[model samples]
Target: MKFATQLIHGGPAVDPEYGSLCHPLYHSSTFAQQSMDHFGRFDYARSGNPTREALEEAIASLEGGSTGLAFASGMAAISSTFLLFSPGDHLVVCEDVYGGTFRALSTLFARWGLTVTFVDATDISAIGAAILPHTKAIYLETPSNPLIKITDLRQAAALAKRHGLLTIVDNTFMTPYLQRPLELGCDIVLHSGTKFLNGHSDVVCGFAVTADPEVGKRLQFIQNAFGAVLGPQDSWLVLRGLKTLKVRMEQSQSAAGQIVQWLESQQCVTKVYYPGLPSHPGFQVHREQASGAGAVLSFELESYILTKRLLEGVKLCAFAVSLGGVESILSYPARMSHASMPAEEREARGIKDTLVRLSVGLEDPADLMADLDRVLNG
Candidate 1:
């Protein structure tokens, strides 16, 4: 089926209990067994929920993966994926990753004996040099969080395959519509469904899809064991949001292109980091794999005070954390999202206090541009 068609009708034919066209919420925490032997695919809410299952099935199909797991939040999903490895295992991660993921690995996972090596994932040679004999996997975010660095998925997959390592990609930025990592040979794909997949800020959710059935099964075990599965209501809301993902993304991307060009022309802006810009270092590499430049873009202001002014001055864009909402949202990585990382660490990766990331929304580009111009020029 076409991507758009699949987004709306990828899972079950109808709601199991109500026979409704839409997937119904299964709110019960536990299920009853007909006999001493458990029957019918569900035992408890943590293990399974019909609504959550339906959403997972949809994501799995959409991502071309064997199975899918949904989580309470994106970090929970990422942490669960990392759980596949044990103590003493090494992981090579992109330097400019999402702040929460950085905190999870450097602070939490490091304490558990997981050694992490940061590298410029965009440079394949750097990634190769960083990999240790104990390296179990490579975790990366393409068109990376604040800097917009693009990693070559196929190249990384080939390298991982040669060394018997796993390749896990955070596909939250592009969503399944723009890129399907499984087809690129990535072992697993992760998403902050709170972003593009959910397309609205109301739901905080995460999802993982694996091309390998065995890997999928192992992830399922971890999900059930860890019990961070997303609730039924959130799952249903995600399903609803996903229905309009194609349209929402199309409009948002269109606006982002315009915004990036405008930002580049502004005197208050030092540099604009967007894969859509032809001058961007990651532009060609990103175009080689993904279909379009995603909506999220980051830029550096002339100064921290200017950054604060631009953020506070914007009337239309939301001055908030997180991305991929119907309303445009702005975030300061240094203070809001990646504040946990130390100043030196963040600087080494190209994320600065003056960096401002924008999640372009569905609003008219003209209005959005006018508001931004007023803020910057005023």
Candidate 2:
């Protein structure tokens, strides 16, 4: 089935017991057993739930993976994926990945005895050189957070395959509609359902889809052991969000292009990092892997003070941390998302104090442009 069709109707014909068209929230924490044997696949909510399972199946099918595991948050999904690696195992990761992922690897995971090497993923040689005998996985975030760096998933996946390393990707920005990393040879695909997948900024959730059954089993065990599974209402929200993903992404991407163009034309702006622009270094690599230049883009103002002024001055867009909401949102990565990383480390990754990232929503292009113009020109 096609992506759009599979999104709405892929998991089940309808809720089995209730015969409801929409997935019903199984609010109970425990289910009853008929014969003191297995209780029809779900015995506890922490282990599994019908609503979460339906959402998981939908994501798995949508991303063309063997199965999906839902989590409490994006960090939980990432941490659970990392749990597949043992203490002595090493990992190769993008330097400009999401802030929470970065913290998890550099701080928490490091404390737990796992070794990680951060490299510029766009440079194939850098990635190749960083690989060690202990390297068990490569964690990549294409169109990386704040910096908007694009990693060539096909090339990276080929390298991982040659080295017998697992490839895990954070597919939050592009969503399954634009990019399916697993189909491009990535072993596991992840999403922060709080963002574009939920589409409304009303929920925080995460999911991991895998082609390997062993990986799926390992993840399921960790999910159950750790108990970070998504709640029923959030699962329902994600299910509703998936239904309109194609339409919402199209609108968001269109508005983002207009915003990027406007940012490039402004005198106060120094540089714009967006895949849609010809000037973007990773434009070709991005186009080779994904369908559209996603809705998030970052630009640098001439001064840090000016950057602060613009963020505060923008009336229409919310000054916020998270992205992928239906309403326009703006963020200062230096302070908000990437704040956990030390200043020197963030600077090394090219996330400067003058940089501001925008998640373009479904707002009218003219209104967004006007609001931005007031900040850039006023």
lDDT of 2 at 183: 92
Per-candidate TM vs. native?
0.98, 0.98
Per-model RMSD to reference: 1.1, 1.1
Tens digits of lDDT, candidate 1, 109-205: 9999999999999999999999898999998899798888999999999999999999999999999899889999999999999998998899999
lDDT of 2 at 277: 95
Task: Show the lowest summed lDDT stretch of 10 residues, model 1.
Answer: 8-17
What candidate 1 gets wrong by more than 4 Å, as runs, is 16-19
lDDT of 2 at 259: 86
Find the 10 residues in a row with the least total lDDT in model 2.
7-16
| Residue-level lDDT for 57 in candidate 2 | 91
